[model samples]
Target: MTPGLINGHLHVSQHLLRGFVPLAVSDTSAYLFKWVFPYYETLTSREEGVAATLAGCDLLTKGVTMVADGGTVRHPGVVADALATTGIRAHLGGWSWDHASAPPGLSMDTTEALDRLSGAMDEVAGRHPRIAPLATTIGLGMSSDALLEGAKSLADRHGTFLDFHHSFDAGEVESHRSSFGDDVTPVEHLERLGILSDNVRLVHQIVSTAAELDAIQRTGASVVRCTGTRAARDLAELRGRGIPVGVGTDTVNVSNTSDVLRALHVFAAEIREPDSDIPSSGLSADDLFDMCTVGGARTLGVASFAGSLEPGKSADLVMFDALRPEWIPMIDPVNQLVLSADGGSVESVWIEGELVVDRGRVIGVDELALCQEAEEAAAGVLMRMGARARIGRRSLC
Candidate 1:
């Protein structure tokens, strides 16, 4: 059995948007404001719960036993309830913003935003005791300096982890430079705010400067590098700096897959030039595998509870069927696991000593029926948001 994989960054509510939205990698603002934000606004609490359930089921079947959710602002309780039912260990954060204006149709001022976040911290503790509270800064560019500081303060007080989006795309980098100044990058801004800490987990530090990278290393803060966004050189540099780097699939709308093995494969292969010497990358299959497991656990601040198979640790592990075609002639277990094997090789999964997936299927839920519901929910949401007309393709079939 392999140690259960952990997805260090995920958006549980955005699972329904998979394949529904066209990704415009160049125009981050249009993608968020036009498609993503509006679609989120259309979801009812029930729909959100259904989406979260679908996501959890997908991850479980893919041998992911734990996740750190980037919670939606509308109905985080719904997401918590779904995750609880699915039996996946998770740390959840609430929707938070203060500096920038709320997206269209959403009403939020700084006072209301802080108040909502404070209430969410208490709500998650009272309602979902298993789920830890994570200080959230929607994104560095979107969150004000006050909000960032407040989030860190909240995390410190609760002794929990802080999660937030950082420099993932060009638009965000431009925004950060414009908002703060030309000299100070987003990482420097975070350092100046005094929010960078060991408890902080910054997502997608793709465009960070040397000073910012220095700050991250000095503060002992971890980073979740999504395979879909960052290059191999960037990852090698982060690893060389002795930073605890974890792998994440990001959102369904972004990477479009919840498979950890696929992400692991990308992380391993993307770091080096095809013709270049492999030794130059300074990463091995073992290192990437550790990132998926123990490294991810560390980023989520649950290393003691999960990540590895050891005495006193939670009974979370995955059994890959070695007889499968993908596992045939597996001379190196780590290489096979990282470079070739995928969710299809997963025969069983156990989380907290309980079997959640068996025979390559999630046990408790009728996955097909749940996917059917997700489809209906997605269609309804798109229709309500009037985004169906904007869909690039006329027919999905």
Candidate 2:
């Protein structure tokens, strides 16, 4: 049997783009404004539901009982309902993008954005307690950044955590350097905004320097490593510092569902890059396992509720069929899981002592039907935007 897995970070709506586009968009600026927002603007609540439900159902099959849906579209409540229907536990966040000079198609009044997010949270919270909806602010992760302060205030008022993408890669670092003069990194910016608190759950953070890492450690803030998309060294350094870090699949851009096993294995392999002479002996398979299960729960501040299979904790457990050819030796179950297990191995999944998925199938979902709906939605939206043919075409040459 597999331990209950907590998907520390994910954006459910991104599931529709899984395997449909390139892994990473080359033209991030044009893609975000021209294609992403324009296409997303066409997304209906039902469409978002279909995407979240499909992704959540897949997580059930992968032994992932919990997920932090980092941010949702306009009607986040609809996404929450989809998760409830799929029998997956989720922390649904209502995202807010408020700035006068924000990117095109993303500008919204600060007060209006907050109001909408609050309304969405109240609506989702009233529907299901498992769907812990919170108002979130998205920023480039710089200290004292406008978005960071807003996230802190909103989180305090709602008793919820603020999720932000922090120091994703070298490109973001350069942007921060350009926006704020030298001698300041993005993490320091978050510190200045009073956002590096226990209530903050920063995602990615691949580019944080040693000093910033120490700063985050001092704040007692948790780091969520999207190992599926991040370089392995990024996660290993945090682990070495004895910092609290969790693993995530990080949207369909990396993979469809937030399967912790995939993330852990990738992280382990990545830590052994050629340039870095770091010995991989100390980081065992179990260490990676811990990062996905208990480690994830700790990052999300839900350890008391459902990290391990202790008697009193909520009985969120996953059982994988051990009869597969991948289990040839089967000497160590955890090791076998990381090396061989995929979403298909999940045989049963339980959440809060309830049988949410049994026999590798979500309790109340039709996989084929959901796929068809999602396909139709994607086509409809793409066509409506008058840019259907340019979906994944790039003029890199």
TM-scores of all candidate predictions against the true structure: 0.92, 0.90
The local lDDT score (0 to 100) that residue 120 gets in candidate 1 is 74
RMSD of each: 3.0, 4.4
Candidate 2 lDDT: 0.73
RMSD of 1: 3.0
- How well does candidate 1 score on lDDT at residue 149? 81
Lowest summed lDDT across 10 adjacent residues in model 2 is found at 388-397
Cα lDDT of model 1 overall?
Answer: 0.79
Q: What is the lDDT of residue 278 in candidate 1?
A: 31
Number of backbone collisions per candidate:
1, 6
Q: Report clash pairs, candidate 1.
A: 232-271
Alpha-carbon shift of residue 370 in model 1 (angstroms)? 1.9
Candidate 1: regions farther than 4 A off: 99-101, 275-280, 389-397
lDDT of 1 by residue, 257-282 (tens): 88878887776666555764334455
Per-residue lDDT tens digits of candidate 2, residues 278-394? 446577777788877888888777888777878678888888788988777689877788767666778889887789888977888877777777777766666776745445433
Q: What shift in Å separates residue 66 of candidate 2 from its native position after superposition? A: 0.6
